[model samples]
Each structure stands twice: as structure tokens, then as C-alpha cells.
Target: MPADLIFHHYANSPFSEKIRLIFGYKQLAWKSVIVPNILPKPDVLALTGGYRKTPVLQIGADVYCDTALICDVLEHLRPEPTLYPPHLKGVCRIFAQWADNTLFWAAMGYNFQPKGAAQVFAHAPPDAAKLFAEDRKSMMAQLVRLRPGDATSAYRSYLRRIANMVDEHDYLFGAQPCVADFAACHSIWFTQTQVPVMADILNATPSVGEWLQRMMSLGHGTMAQFDSAGAIAAAKAAEPQPPGANYLVDSAFQDDHGIPLGARVAVGGESFGPEPTEGTLIAATRTHYTLLREDDRTGAVHVHFPRLGYTLRKVEAG
Candidate 1:
């Protein structure tokens, strides 16, 4: 059976935009379920247990959280348009990691300042913008956010570096687009496409603008809109599948958090978005971990999160 692919995301989400581009690049038919920009994502919470990040990919009973993991799932389903090429795999992975972490956040911090923030929230209600700001503030917690001036500087520098990369070749890695290109382009795309008033930073690097045009050409292919309600119903109707037995990364004892398997825990991503996901640790592999939990709406869905940014803590077992 061809596994069902459901994308739980909103349009304004830059990370979600990255996956949408991937879906279009691969020409994969998927059900688009628009999720909320901020918290109280009950439907997404239903599928993910508690990993309330945007762009959760639902494949059968498996719920993949984070755009990084979603990329892996998409690659598994469609290998034709490979995001990570064999020769450029290492460099692509490094560049992608840098782009997703550093570039993406800097761009967002800069793009969501007063000027760009107004452009984004122009259509949204006053309360809507306030709620979004409050929600993001809660998620950020102790993390230090860059000042608008600093953020703008960092973003401009990052854009120049990206332009330098494109100056050598058509894409970040080479002639064809790679994971790094998509990851980097999406953030820049958000500034240029979503918040054009603040897009003047791209003027210093016209090469980045030309590159973005090419990226835009790879349009988000035919996505039939699917309701979040229907997606929750689909997940509710299904049975949870066994977790993948194979380990995807190297297992090294990095942290002192000696949490055992099957222990109830809450894992929160360090920066950007710090929402905590609570569940039973089903699989603590080398790279990622799988959590099994019951949701009132969706019954059960195995949610996955990358180990890098997330901090795992033991929750009181009932």
C-alpha cells in the first residue's frame, strides 16, 4: 500500500515552505493540512503527541516532526530528486545544518522586526499578532534573540556568503539544487517573498536574487487541500506501527541526562522554538528518538525528533 502522506503546516511558515518546495521538486502528491502559526495546535498535538513544530509529516501511523526529519521521510518516499547527492552529501549536510540553524533564525529575527512584522501582520487581526508575539516569546524562553540591528547585519552577511556560493555555481553545491540550497533559499525567500519591504538587504547581493528566482521556478506542485480535522480523523482511524528498528546515526554518550528507555520524558528544542513534547521514549537511536503517546483526538501516532537541538528530561511516571 502506498503510505498516506499528510503535511500539517501553514503557508507563512518558512520551514514549511522548504518542505513544500521539496514536495514540488519531487512531484509528490500530498494532502495539505493548514496548521496554526502559534500554539494550541490541538490537531497537530493529536498526531505528534506534543512535538508541536510546524510541518509535521504523517506517513500512515508515523508522525515525523521537524523539517529535517520530514526531509528524510520525503527522500525515502521519492529518491528521484535527491536532496543530498552522493558526492556532495557531507558538504550538503554541513551547509544544510548551518542554514537551518543559523541562517533561518537570523532571517526570521530580522524579518519579524517592526517593519517586516507590520507587513506580515497587516492582514492579521491586532489580537492575532499579539498572540503570535506572545506565543513565540514563550517558546524562546531563555534564548537570547538578536537585536533588529544585529539581526539585520548578520542576515546581510549571510546573504553575501550565499551569493558567493552561487557565484561559483548555479546552486549552493553545484548546477542542481541540493538540501543546502533549499534550506538557505527558504529563509531568503521568506524575506524577499513574504516580507518584501525588508528585502532590500538582497540588493547588495543580486546573485542571491537571481538564485531565488530559480528556486521560485520550482513551484510547489499540485497540492490538494486537506482539512486538519480530516487528518486527525485519518490518524484516529489508523493503528500505530512498530518503530523503526535501525539506528540512523552514531550513538555517542554526549549528555549526562541518564534517562532510561520507556521513561516518561519531555524533550524541548533549545532555540528558535522551545515547545516541549512529552511521551514514552520508545526508541533512543544514534541520531533521533521516537516517542509513543496517546492523543485524545488521534488515538496514537509515533512522533520523531532530532536529538541535536532537543533536551530530554524524565517526567514522573504514573
Candidate 2:
């Protein structure tokens, strides 16, 4: 039987939209659990230890933190619509990473300018914008954020580059959409769907806009409403898949940090959203880290973080 995919995310979250679109392209059936846009994400913390990034994917007792890993897991589960197509495999991943980080931040910096911010928070409570700003500030204090004007310039150039690619092909790559397309489209999706007031930035590259429509048409796959309570229950009742249960298991532990498999460790993103998820390191594969963390509400759930953008630290014996 296929494991139930429980997705925790808010509707307006751009990162979440990327995963949702991938779900559509792959024709996945998943359970949706809406999470708060702001912090005090009690439900999220209970499952992930402390990593509170949007759009956490939970399958049974396994919680995948980042979208990159989530995409890999989904690909492993359902390989038909392969995320990393062979011809475009290496380039697709590199492009996806750039789009997810550089393009995403640049688009966001442009999207959340004063006018865009006002429009984005217009429907929310008066203090929503301020709170959201402050919250993001605290979470990303160590990282250098783009300035609105600078971001606008960068975003425009990126759009033109994207247009060049899509002008020749339907997607970022060829006819079929790859992970790069999903990664690139989310911020543009945000601009069009959530902050149309600022979407004019997309006009310079009409081809990109055309590409966006094509990507949007994929639509989120089959979905059912689920509550965080039910998700917690599912985690509690299920045991984590054995180490390397799927091909996700690496042949041998690759130890650059000198941290053993059984050691207590904290895994977190390298820059943005550095909040660590502390637990016993059950698996430290070349591509990811698996943390076995226990909670009163959720029992033991394996929290996985991709190695590319994340850091791992062993907790010294106390």
C-alpha cells in the first residue's frame, strides 16, 4: 500500500505552492493540513523538533523538512514522472537550486516592496504585515537579504534569462517539466496569484508569463483535508522505515563531520531558517540526514533534511 502523504502548509506560501504543483505534475494523492503563516507553529514543532519551514511532508513516521528532499522522496515513491530526467538530471538539479534560492529570494524581495506588502496584508489584521516582517527578520537574521530595488533589477534579468529558455521549449527544459520548472514557477506563481499588484514585473518577459500559465495548468493532484491532530496520530502509530528502507539508504555512512550514526546531533539549514532539529542521527547518507526525534504527542518520527543546504553538528556528551 502507498504511504499516505500528509502535507503541512499554508495556502499562500510560495514554497508550498512549488510542492503542490509538483504533486500535480506527478498526479499524486495527498492529505493537506494547513499550517499558520506565522510562528508558534506548535503542530509543526512537535513533528520536526524545531525546523519550522513551510510545507513539511510527512509520510507515516517520516517527516521530510526541505522541498528538495521531499521531491526526491516523492520521486522514489512514484517514479513515472521522474523529477530528475536523465538528459537534464545534473543541470536540472543545479538550476532548481538556483531558482529555489537566488531566484526565489530576488522575486520575494521585489514582491514584498512597500506597495506589494500593503496589498498582501490588506485583507489581514492591521498588524499582520509588521508581525510577518519581524518574524522573518528574526528567523533570517544571520543571512543577508536582498534590497527591494536591487532585487527588482536581479529579478528582471532572471526573468529575461528564463524567457530565453522557455522561448525555445515549453518548460524550463524540454517538453516535460522537470524539478527546475517547479522551483522557478513558485515565486512567479506568488506574484500572479497572491500579489497581482506587483505582477507587472513579469511583463518584461512575456514568454515567462506564458510559461507560468502552462505550469499553472498542471494543477495540484488529488487531495483530501486532514488535521494536524490526525497527522500527529499517524506519526505516533507508525514506526519509521528501517534505515535505508527505500533506496534512500546510502551504502555506507559518509562522515565528513566525524559524527557517528548513533550520536546525538542537530541538523539545520545552512543559512536561511537555521533552526535545528535535534535528535539521534540514525542515517547520515551523502544526500541527507535522518534524525530520530521523540515527542510526547508524536512519539518517534524520523525527520530528514537534505545535505546540500543543511548543516549537521554532533552534540557533545553532557
Candidate 3:
């Protein structure tokens, strides 16, 4: 039997919500492991090394970082209600990438205005806002963020484009939801659900709002709470699953960075949450790079990251 799906994420994470909705769409039961919203993410770092991002998916001894890779894993596991439609796979993937990054940033920029930020931290501890800001600021060091006024304008324009897409079909591409739908929904979902005060921005695009309601109705599938310690123990006890011969047979070593397989390397995001994860390069496919790393708590594991929007480097010898 396949090992249980273990997800590490928090409630307010928009990316996590994307996976959760995918679970609902697939009707898959999963183990939910909630981690701290802000650092220090000791438990998460235990598995990801330094990739302190929310919503890391753990299957047996394999750890998948980045929602893009997680979505691929989920689709591979259950191909019934496909995330990538056969005919529109390329288009769906391109649209999803844009939604995950471009749309997400614009939505967040608009959502976290002074008014929305106050509403978000209203019920939290006094220092919650400050700590959250500092944590995000550290992750976003050297990256440019859109200002509220500019974000509002861009977000509105994006919404109108989305409105045009969904004006005819029920989803962005067609009658059924695809990877692009889930990716786009999460960002807008945050504004509508987490920051209702500023949600009026979505009101202008009635079509987008209606589409969001449909996506929201899917709800998160069956979920059971799983603690960090238990998750770590599970990983420690299981052996890493070997990739199928077919899995890597056709996937030749596409060396873009000149880093050979078995070399020590560090992979990380190009912009936000730039903590580098160091490990031995195991697989370098056209789309992603996989690393084999060991942790005292989790033993041997394979951490996967998408090639795009991320940087790869050789870890210098000490």
C-alpha cells in the first residue's frame, strides 16, 4: 500500500489552501501537520533543511517542496480527476505558473494594505503583525514588492482578465477546473476569506467572485490531524522509495548548471523564502531538480523543487 499523504501547513496559508482544495477535488484523505506561520520553523526545517516555506508535502520518506512539485506528485498519485487535462496540459501549466506567482503577488500586495493588515492581525497577539512582517521581510530581502496603489490597479486589471476568461466557461480554461484554477483560486481566496474588509476589491468582478464561490464549495477533503513528532517518526521508520526505472530512464541528466549527479549542491528560490537546501544531486530533469538529503529525524529523503523560479548552486567545500 502507498504511504499516507502528510501535509505540513498552517490555516491562513494561501498556498496550503490550494493543495487542500485539490484534495477536496480529488476527494483524497490526508494527514494534516500544522507548522508555525513564522520562524523559527524547527520541525519544517528538520525535513526541508532550510526551505522554510509552508505546505511541504511528505509521502513516506520523500519530501516535496514547492506547490508546483506537490501538484505534480498529487496528480501522479491520482490521475482520475486530472489536474492537467490531456489536450491543454501545456496551457494549463503555463496559466498555473502565472497564477501562482504573478496573480498571487498582486493579490497579496492588495490584500496586505494597511487596512487589510490590521484586520488580519486584529485577533492575534500584540506582536503578531510585527513578527510576521519581519519574517516576511527577511524572506523577501532583495525582491521588489508592489505598493498598495500600484497593486490595486494591477490586481483590478488582472481580475478583469480573469473575468473575461471565466465569462463563458465555468473555469479559467473550460467547463472543469484545472491546475490553473486551483492556483488562481488560492490568492483570491485569501482576500475574500482572510481579509473580508478589503474583499470589496473583488466585488467589481462578479464573474470572478462567482467562480471563487464554486471553487470554495469544493471544500477541503477528509483530513486528520497529525503532529510534527509523529510525522518525523513516520519518516524515520520508512525507507525511501526507489524511483521507477521508467521514471528516470527517459529523463537524461539535463545539466544547465554543470553540476553533475552525485555532486553536493544547494537549491533555493530566486526571490522569496531564499533559504538554500543543500544535498546530493540525485535527478535533474527538464522541469525539476531532486536532491537526496539525510536528517537525524527523517533519515534519507528526496526533496524536489521545480526548475523555474529557483536557483541552483554548488555548495562550496568548507
Candidate 4:
């Protein structure tokens, strides 16, 4: 039987939209657990410990963080309509990483300008904007954000580059949509769907606008609502199914941090949402790391994070 795929995410999360689009592309049904858009995500923290980022993929007793790793999990689950087409595998990965990090940051910096934030919080409570600002400030403590004017200039240039990429093919890299296409689409999607006033930035690139329509048409696949309590209970009752021997393994133990398996460690993002999750290091592969952790509410679980864009360190005991 197929494993139960539970997605913990909020509707407005751009990364969540990327995964949702992937789900649509794969025609996979999944359980949706909507999380809060702000801090004090207690329920979410109970599962992730300290990795408080939105859009975490929970499978039985295994929790996968980061869209890159989650994409690999989804691909492993349903191999057809592969996200990483064999021919463009490495190129697609590199492009997707750029889109997810650099392009996404530029688009977001532009989208959250004073004018766009005003539009976003227009319907919300007066303090909603302040709260969001404080929350994001804390999450991105030391990370440098581009100025609105600079971000706007960069965003436009990036959109033009994307237009060039999709000018000939229906999607980036080929006729069929790949990881790069999905990674690039979410940032644009956020601007169009959530902040239409700012979406004028996309107008200059007509090809990109047309491609966005094609990407949007994929639609989210069948989904069922799931409550946090139910998800917690499911995790409590399930045993983690970490990658088996058949799974990809690094030839050498590739130890750069001097951390070893079975040691207590913490893994987290280097910039935004830098909260670290501490656990017993279980598996450290070439592409990702796995942590074996247990909670009273969720029982034993294995949390996974991609090696890229994350920091791993030994937890110093008091």
C-alpha cells in the first residue's frame, strides 16, 4: 500500500504552492494540514522541533524539510512524470536551486515593498502588518534583504531572463515541465495571486506571463483536509521508514563537520527561519541528512534535511 502523505502548510506559502503544483503534475492525492501564517506555530513545532519553516512534508513518522528534499521524496513515491528528467538532470537541479534561492529572494523582496505590504494587509487587522514584519525580521535576523528599488530592477531583469528561457519551449528546459519550471513559477505565482497590484512587474515579460498560465493550469490534485491532532496521532502510531539499503548511498563517509552518526546534532537553515532542530544523527548521505528524534506527542520520527542551504553542527551539552 502507498504511504500516507501529509503536507503541513499554509495556503499563501510560495514554497507550498510549488509542492502543490508538483502534486498536481504527479496526480497524487495527499492530506493537507493547514498551518498558521505567523509565529507561535506550536503544533508545527511539536513535529519539527525547531525548524519552523512552512510547508513540511510528513510521511508516517518521517518529516521531510525543505522543498528540494520534499521534491525528491515525491519523486521517489511516484516516479512517472519525473521532475528531474534524465537528460537535463544536473542542469535542472542547478537551475531549480537558483530559482528557489536567488530568483525567489528577488521576487519576494520586490513583492513585500511598502506598497505591496499595504495591499496585502489591507483586509487584515491593523496590527497584522506589524506582527508579520516582526515575525519575518526575527526569522531573517542576519540575512541581507535587497532594497525595494534594487529588488524591482533585479526582478524585472530576472523575468526577462525567464522569458528568454521559455520563449521557445512550453516550459523551461523542454516541452515537459521540470523541477526548474516549478521552482521558478511559485515566486511569480505569489505576485500574481496574492499581490496583483505588484504583478505589473510580470507584464513586461509576455512569454513568462503565458507560461505562468500554463503552469497554473496544472491545478492542485485531489486533497483531503486533515487536522493537526489527527496528524500528530498518526505520527504517534507509525514507525519511521527511513531510506532502505536500495536507496542512494555515498561511497565515502564524507565528513566535513567532524560530526558522526549517533551523535546529537542540530540542523537548520543558515539565513531565514534559522531555528535548529536537534536530534540523534542517523544517516548522512551525499545529498541529505536524517535525524532520529522522538516526541511524546508524535512518538519516534526521522527528520530529513537536504545538505545544501542548511547548516549541521554538533549540539553542545550543558
For all candidates in order, the CA lDDT equals: 0.81, 0.91, 0.89, 0.89
| Clashing pairs for predicted structure model 2, backbone only | none
Q: Is candidate 1 or candidate 4 better by lDDT?
A: 4
Please provide, for model 4 over 1-318, each residue's C-alpha lDDT reduced to its tens digit, 9 standing for 90 to 100: 256789999888999999999999999999999998898988788888889888999887888899998998888788889999999999999999999989999999999998888988999998999998888888899688898889989999999999999999999988999999999999999999999989988888999999999999998988999989988998898888755521223324557789988899999898888889999988887888888888888988888888998999999888
Provide the lowest-lDDT 10-residue window in model 1.
245-254
- TM-score: which candidate is best? 2
Model 2 misplaced regions, further than 4 Å: 246-251
Query: Per-residue lDDT for 9-124 in model 3, tens only?
Result: 99999999999999999899999999999999888888888899888998877788899988888887777699999999999999999999889999999999999999999999
Model 4 residue 175 distance off true place after TM-score fit, in angstroms: 0.5
| lDDT (tens digit, per residue) of candidate 1 on 188-231 | 98999889999888999999999988988888867888998888
TM-score, candidate number 3: 0.97
| Each candidate structure's count of clashing pairs | 0, 0, 0, 0
Most accurate candidate by lDDT: 2
Pairs in clash, predicted candidate 1: none
Evaluate residue 124 in candidate 1 and report its C-alpha lDDT on the 0 to 100 scale: 88
How many angstroms is residue 10 displaced in model 2 relative to the true structure, after the best TM-score fit? Answer: 0.6
Q: What TM-score, over all chains together, does every model reach?
A: 0.93, 0.98, 0.97, 0.96
